[model samples]
Target: MRFSPVTQLSTRFDSVASDIAERLPDTTAGGPALAAGLGIGHVLVAGWNLTREINEFGAEMGPLMAFGLIGGAGLTVCVLAVRLFYSEFDSKQRWLVGWSAVGGATLFGAIVYISILVRLAEGRVIAEPIFVLSLASGMGAVAGVVVGELYATALQSAAVADRQRDQLEFMQSLFRHDVMNSLTVIQSRAEFLTQDTDGQNNRFAETILEYAQNIVGLADRVERMSDVITGRGEIETSPTELRPIVERQVTPLRKSHEEITFDVDVDEVTVVADSLLEEVVGNLVKNAVEHGYDGSDDFTVSVWTTSTGGRTQLHIADTGTGISEELRGEIFERGTSESGSGFGLFFVETMVDHYGGSVRVEANEPSGSVFVVELVTA
Candidate 1:
């Protein structure tokens, strides 16, 4: 899924705020303390400015006073809402609440700055904008934080619901498309084998075995994919040694396909990933070995890694019949290509992204194709 630029900016803002909140001296008191400060700030900024409007400039009010009132009300709501739901708010919600101050400050700061500039143009020598901007912004920040936390709560709930729905749909699809179909094939093949007069039919047995293996492989792949996809919690990652993992996964493939030449030059590099990284390496190697060999005995699969710009790029090149030009675009999507369940490519895409990395297929220098996976260097 893609996000708009505005959405992306807001997300970044929330993330930065969350980080700061987490790093506070008292991690427990960080968010609430900051929230309380914002409430006090709103009162000070609005109260001081409003006092001047009434006592110094007479009973008539101004935009600054109105802005102060709005900011105070927003701050009140924010504080109330946060206090009410403080116990239930997770890290995601807390960060969003932190962003409220940011939003409020930004909006009100601009308004006050613009308003003061207009007064100066009209030959009114009033208070300095900086002093007022600071206070007015405080009022806005409190209000902004109020809205942020509330919105965060709603958004987080929606995200959880969406994830659960996707999981349900994913399970439904597996049962309907993989298990049901494989079971039907297995049942039919078993009947044929049983009905064989001499009991010497290998085709039925082979077909059943093939389908069973597929189901098993699908189950393993689904588990690996689940580890990458964000379910109810965040995926944890550690610095995984890439060279050892790559070497291990490819060892079996090399032994099974002795006819095919294997060239490996992986670096002894580490990356921010987990044990599932092994599954990624395994699937990629299996994909190349299985799909790259067609008819000839001159098949070769090359694996290499390069580290540059804090990224470790793993390249898997195959010298055989390459993927069709038409299929390359949608290969990463779920159940996309006609060549099996399309789970392998989808798994690679999902896992790599979870590792804050990317995977793409490119045309090799001569024949066949190359899969380039770029992961963050540990």
Candidate 2:
């Protein structure tokens, strides 16, 4: 088959991208080896230069001083490299600074050695042996400064990440254990009051119980958000049937929002998702009913699922005033909504990402918006 230039270039680009992606993770493991190689190179070049000088000038402080400076600088750089390799400063800047310092030191040493040899060959003793020692010391000092800066920056970044992770973990524990327990007690008391009361008092007790349940739900979401931020939660995938889960979530909404109609048309397909799949579908439906309704009894929400090419797509669409183009762009971002509790869609997005899926917002036919969640079928 004939191929165009663009096609050839794209093929080559994909090949290169695949190669890089496969090798990228192992680059860090190669850091210590690379550093050691550079150190050995410095030692060999410096040793050769010093040996030649010693042959001509006999045993002197110059050759010994040169040997000490090269050995010390190379050892220092190697130690720093090893530290960096094991440290948590996995950043491009750290590698750049480290390699640049090593290159600069080696270049400086090579230039100095060449200059001394050129002068000696011409029978012109340009300066004393002390001059050579001074030059090596200067190069070592410059390399030391660069290595020091790299070490400090790496350490600082690692520390900051650790502190943030610790704080998030503490917050997650507090919410999951302490706050959840307190909310449970309040909900239980409210439920008891609802059971014991009559007439107007009973309605008030039910309202308290409803709000309590909402608070508990909010706490659970907050805990999940903390887990996502700290990267402490592991995604446990399983084959989850979609139709029953969707129906279970929608059934409660039907009772709560009698004014809104829900149309479900999901296939009995299983997806590679966790238990949190229900929360994802529930949030999408709740958000639609809460935001899509315009105080009209004619409001309708539709959910459907379709499978194609090894992927399952679950769509939740609403029939009310559609979202504006501006709002649609930032709607999934946390804290982007006017409502203080803007973590609903954020949780949905995080869970979908964990499940190796994707979610997008699109304009529904005629009016309202549609949330399309695409996941891999197991």
Candidate 1, poorest ten consecutive residues by summed lDDT: 24-33
For all predictions, the C-alpha RMSD in Å is 12.8, 13.9
For all candidates in order, the CA lDDT equals: 0.74, 0.75
Give one digit per residue, the lDDT tens place, for model 2 in 1-378. 999999897577446534543554345545445555566655665677678878989889977787777766666666766776776644443444344455565567677778888888999877655446445643653474365356447556767999989887876787579877887898899899999999999999899889888888777766665666568767779999999989989999999888888899998899999777878898889888888887777789999998889999999999988788888888889887645488889888888988899999999888889999999999
Clashing pairs in 2: none
Give the CA lDDT, 0 to 100, for residue 207 in model 1. 68
* Candidate 1 residue lDDT tens string, 26-55: 343445555666666666666666666567
lDDT of 1 at 105: 78
